[model samples]
Target: MKRRGPFANRRLARFCHEEAGSILVLWIASLVAILGMTALVFDIGRVQIAHGDLQRFADDVALAAAAELDGRSDSITRATNAASKLISNPQAYGGDGTLSGATDYTLTFLDGLPAADTTDPSGYTTTDPIDATLVQVVTTPVTLDPMFLRATRTLAGVTGPAQATVFAESIAGFSMEACDITPLMFCKPTGWSATQASSIGDGILLRSGGQGAAWGPGDFGFLDVSSSAIGSSCFGLNGAKLIGCLIGAEDNVTGCYAQRGVTIEPGQKVGLENAVFNTRFDQFRGVMSQFKSNANYTVAPNIISGLVPQGNACGWNNVSASTNSIGLPHDNCFATGGCTRFGTGSWDYANYVDSNYGNRNGILEAGEDSHLVSHIPAAFAGTRYGVYLAEIAYAQTAGLPSGAILSDRDETGIAQCSSNVSTNPARRVVIAAAIDCTKHPINGAATNVPVDEFVELFMTEPVGTGVGSPPSFDLWVEVIGSAGVAGLGAAGTGGVFRDVIQLYR
Candidate 1:
């Protein structure tokens, strides 16, 4: 209560008026603000990254589910399982526990899936699962912490609970238009069970040295010839009564691209030796190989060695005079069924034609056409044709040594994973547009029909036995693409609009 000293008063004044510490105070305040902002940014970045992961999860689930829309009976169950698996599965990066399940998603079956051209992802109408061509999946909101943001806000003492939630969505589907399509067609019989399509999709239905006519999907290799052959007459008689009939045929089925308006004519024999096959096999080395379509809509060359070499050698030996009639016969072997039948022949003999050397199921040659006989005389032609046909049949029955199988399966080094067979695993797969052998054509519709399905095949062997046989292929197949109940119409923009797996929206 007494009078204060002058020193104390001066000290108080100095403390109050001093500017020396003010700069430090300002700096600390500024640093706090900057740190808060920086933390906010880091938290926002974390949220964004988590959102991206959620989005990818959506996309992956969509694709996994959509692939099940191939007109199979178990489409819904399969698709649901696919989505659940993706959602409940661990994270791709962190291996974290799953955040969602099938119940957390909204799946829609699309009759016509929205293409990339559709600006809105909602362009499609939901269809029944049985008829769905596409599947869509959306996930529930997934919560993630605003880690740095909350921490900074807490340090600033200015925020309530601060966390973020995110969601992601996607659409997926497949397209099957003539664009970028291999020129082949198969019949999807009018009355087929849903199981039939699944059977083909199941993989590796047919294989060389595995089974005969009783083996897998279609017993004989009766693929429809392309209606658009280079030459007018049946050059190699791929569609002839002798060869095609021997392989097998459907009443209303013609192997042509129906979408292009090219129909197969009745009994219109077309050769398999066209520029397309040659360019694809010989030039591109794609026999029993996989090829992706280029911008030109043509298949690119094979990356690995393929069966084209063996096929070329087989064809060459058939045409060479020095090889005599030991190779493929030009037209006569197909004209009259008298070639080396296995039962009647020995290791070596001229046996094609009326079972002179052996007895076997031979397609009676329908008389040599002048234009068709240009490749070689009867003996050479017969041997070539005979060897080819025999090899084809044998392939379906007894899958030959397999180089066509990818190295992943070790070719024939080990047993594979298929329900049908126990030996020689499969590595690569092929998707071909062909008719279903189990299906017959609509009566009185058209002479030669178009392809109604996309068949999935696993290559078994390069079509040959040992070193002497020709390059041939055997497959295990299942139907993938479907024309629905209405039959073949349009699937998508020549596969461009479709992705085996895609991210939409």
Candidate 2:
């Protein structure tokens, strides 16, 4: 309708339809898409990281709980309390920032084999709180917001809740097997059980340079279990015989007690000195602490809480150095302590300690603490003290048995040095691991060798050649876990071997 130049009009049309601006629009769209993907990734990745953290937390709680499952009375309660404390206390791990608070964590005790777990070869069960061998730990579901995802709504104009629920879980348990152990067992006459009285076990005391405190042939307490590699009997009491032969009687070195009437003749098995407590092997290490020292000639107070140790040699006025028959068995069954009942002893040392016997002959004499140890354990890593079970034996069983049915049965392999490798469930060896290298020990349930409890003991000194003076052990022990047997036979002589603590999930 108007007179206009065609070229000019064409130019204007081209400008309006220019493709340069198309690139800008395309870039904007691309940026929106890229932002959406990044935001989604942030949420997914954040949740995944949180999930991993939860898994580790679960494992920690389970292990803590399992350590307290010692297979004795109040075991469940102790385990529960231990696990709950580890979870709830922020000081235990990190805090809610790194790990979920203990309140957000939960643990469950399981007995018997679980349907989901198929890890163990023997498949030990964790059936009851009282006898738990396994524990399950779970974290409360954690909620997280996808910060990048939510932020993208302002730019990309796309949105959702951008939140996630994450959680993790794990299962763990405790068991024991024989590892490096000393051949010597301070013979515990009592088994581990609250109700087990006569068979509960007693803590044995060995005196250096005493009339009857050394190892000898025919003396059955000498064990060969302290070598780098164990040659102890795997099948029976042959180990004990071998050990007794290794450290045979060298001109009456003195290793028999008058109480047991241990008259070690030319070629007869010898017996151990004596147990201070009648049957219960209660706090022997603690009592023996008076005999442990690092200084070459230093002394420690041999403290026996209930009894006053008398020393005629040191001039404390208990009388002559004669064997006290107050608590020991007088029956001449097998020889020295040959009792009609195995693991059952009639300990009368209390009468002497109580001043009933004028002289404390058989019982330990108090003088300067003559501990022969070079290194004082529990000076660091107080959890390293321990002792060897001179003997161990067990009868076969099917399911995880409850309580110590046969506490102290007739276990062989006493004084068998090479055969002193622990193999008997009946012969329980309390093993320990050093938490640190040095720390003075304090007495408590945590350190005591309670019945049915799995303990870790550290061997401070390696075994000296059995050729010289019989090798002795300096150990630190702490109860770290408990156990339930699966394939173990009826205990024979004290059975000891490699045990393990493991996780199923």
Candidate 3:
């Protein structure tokens, strides 16, 4: 309005010059807001990442425990140790906080579980196919303490120092069953036909054994029997009483004579000297009794080791002897010629028996003509008569252990025959095996690398009668990855990956 000159203009401009555009205050305020937001995001993200990591680690530990529930002696201990080792340093897996609180987890067989039973008149309803109990695998709660987030003292009053709990659970079926022993190969000295016998005695001789009865024939130091014979004989004496019989003329010695099958007097022990005792019986009545017993027999590719050496020995060589063997044969009717078949190819082999050691031989030869056929097949059965052995091998590439545990909580060393079932026909023996993901590598890689690691094995008994008959059994095996857990769970944390396997022999 005054229309001043250049000097006037300069004075006015200076006076009008305001600090509005300096923006120092606005910039500082903006910086404070942005920094605060960033800090919130960083701390929250850190806590979240830690929680996620803890969960993942917990899962892995649980899975390890679950895998150990196969009813092994130290399986639970091993799995617990493995779980702790897996997360010993959770930070490696991106966990920002340390888990504190309870240590030690457990893998155990569940008790009082309802037996798998079904009542469908249709006779086609699927019963609880699983014969054993459920295995419960529990993982201890993993607790994590906040580290990065704790700095916000304000949160101490709000939510308090962040704490988290992680858990995992899994179920496993009965890993083991009672020991059952069935004859893989058997022959009454009279049960064998000339065609079934070679110069090597009766082939019907089979073998079996367990914890207390580890004695085998070859191991028989004083007996000096064959190992193969002891292998089978080990099964016979395992739980039975051992009393040596005097080898005198049948009728010549009555007082010192060993009654046919009387219970032995306590504290009295005897041995048959100068004579090797086989299952053979000379009496026609004895021969008839042996033939009428129900004794199923079959054979596998290899012999399983029991408490005693497979060879025949009774505290003789190695402590125990095998009752079944190709060398030392058990015969009820050994005539001058050899094993005599009842009818042409009428001899049959089965695992179930109706009598104990005393009377088992009575029907050994007359199985076809006696009550052996009337005996109903038991619901549970196994390949071997009284004992069942299942061996699982993990290649060095698989991450799993090379050994497996039997149902009886036995670690069954890396060798074969570590797992055993009863030969009784009333029981069944089933084997399910998988290669360790850590030990058995796929694609020839040095390590199996993580995938759906799994392997399925099939066990079967041949369909034929008599010990000398060729074994004609079939088994199927499947190998897969994560799918293996279908029988088990594979949650990667609480999941148990078990390959479902069935045994019907």
Candidate 4:
């Protein structure tokens, strides 16, 4: 090399001192940090989206399963099928895509849940299908291969698990609201279940208690149709308004009642016309005479009460002792006054058949429908309600002859008061809330009294004047079954149950 010049030495020294490219080195290092931050945000967003998808799936499955919990024997089976087979949804972002089969989620049936939503779900679960009312669903955990996080980790020369797992859970329950039900509630007998198999077809004698008297088992009272549960139409209802609600043709005029509880109408409400109850049997008398023509108060298609009209007037005199009169008799225990509110299902079936159809063997001479006969037990011929249905079928097949006249009465199943006859056989059946009187003491004007269950009662006879010195308003009915039971064949007939499903979490 030649001897270094002064200019070259100065240029070299100036070049070493200059800071021109220093910023470029810092910028390259900052790029790595910026990229890592962007990756973190993107991965977090994907995980959040996946969590949202899982939550939705869990909610839908819970609702579907809860809808099928109707307190039936097959409730859990139906709920499981509804949950696994009825719903299919797609999950995007980080899930396994489609959620279809049982493997995609887990189900837990619960009988009770803590009132609060924040409570954990481990303790309140149930295995019994009939008692299960709430349902819980949890999505299967899904492993996610994070798009940005994995690349960020690789670039950093980091090894180990880089995937994320996501899942969600939800709870739901089923409830019912009875609509268009009769404004009536009876004291539930000791140890009565909603679906009491033995109690079906048993005669129940419902008597209205004295004003201000504490109601006990077998006593019944009117419901406050004016309650908010019944809506505004029946609000502020008084004496005449109460009668109108009782006689209204539209079922919803009385409004909807919750299964939880009901408000008791304040008074004993004495002197309600017998005609009001008789209208269901097509016997319109007193105040009910004018409503016969109106379709709303249409009489039942079969109105075969044992009592003959008194001299063509629309009134029934005492025909209970008459041999020719053949109405469905009260239980043998009732005539003797040996039983309490409930009567042994043993009524004189042979006498009923002989007095009405001239058949002593309890078999119709004309061809009888086997379906109707199937419901009648061999030991008792038929239950009062079962016989009532069979009589309808009998009248349909064999033209009503003078011999088949009900209880030596000119009145037959055909309505003479009006041509607009009620075709619904369930017209004679009314839904009544059964309450435990001991647990909930009701005198009058009670609020939010808990109901044990709703029951379907077949009117065995029209409301009648009682025989005691003070006299009572007595109604005789046969228990059909608990409302909405599949075995009863009367589910949804009386607008007794309206099911509602909702998510809890």
* Residue runs of model 2 more than 4 Å from their true location after superposition: 1-8, 16-26, 88-102, 112-127, 150-161, 181-339, 343-502
Residue 199's lDDT within candidate 1 is: 34
Q: Residues 1-505, candidate 3, lDDT per residue (tens digit)?
A: 7677999989779868967756978999798667656766775565566555554544555454444444334644554565556544344223334542225334443322333443211222221222122334344555554454454445345565555455544443323111111111111222212222231122122221111232221111111111112222232431111111111111111111100011111110122121111111111111122211212111122222223333322112232322321111123342333533211211123311212111335344444213322222231122122122222211122233432222222212122321222222211222111222122222111121111112211121211111211111111111111212222433121112323222110
lDDT string for model 4 (1-505, tens) is 7899999999999989989979989999999889888989888888998898889889999999998877667889999999989888888876467877799899999977887778887788888875688899988998888878999888889999799999999999876676677778888766776476677778888987655788888888777666434434444655644654464443435666655458876324644555667777666666567766766676665666665555543444433333354578888998898898888778887666656656445655553243346544453345788787666665565545632324334456556555666667777888888888888887766877766677889888777755443345688898887885322222556765666688877
lDDT of 3 at 195: 20
- Tens-place lDDT digits, model 2, residues 268-384: 123321211111121112222222221211111111112222431122122222232222221233245553222222333334232222343444455311221223233321111
Candidates by TM-score, descending order: 4, 1, 2, 3
lDDT of each: 0.39, 0.35, 0.27, 0.71
Residue 180's C-alpha lDDT in candidate 2? 32
The prediction achieving the highest TM-score against the true structure is 4
Residue 334 displacement in candidate 2 (angstroms): 7.2
* Per-residue lDDT of 296 in model 2: 15
The residue-by-residue lDDT of candidate 1 on 173-243, one tens digit each, is: 64333432333333333443222533322222232211122222332233334453322222344433223
Any idea how many clashes model 3 has? 131
Error of 3 at 47 (Å): 2.1
Residue 283's lDDT in candidate 3: 11
Q: How many steric overlaps are in each model, in order?
A: 61, 104, 131, 1
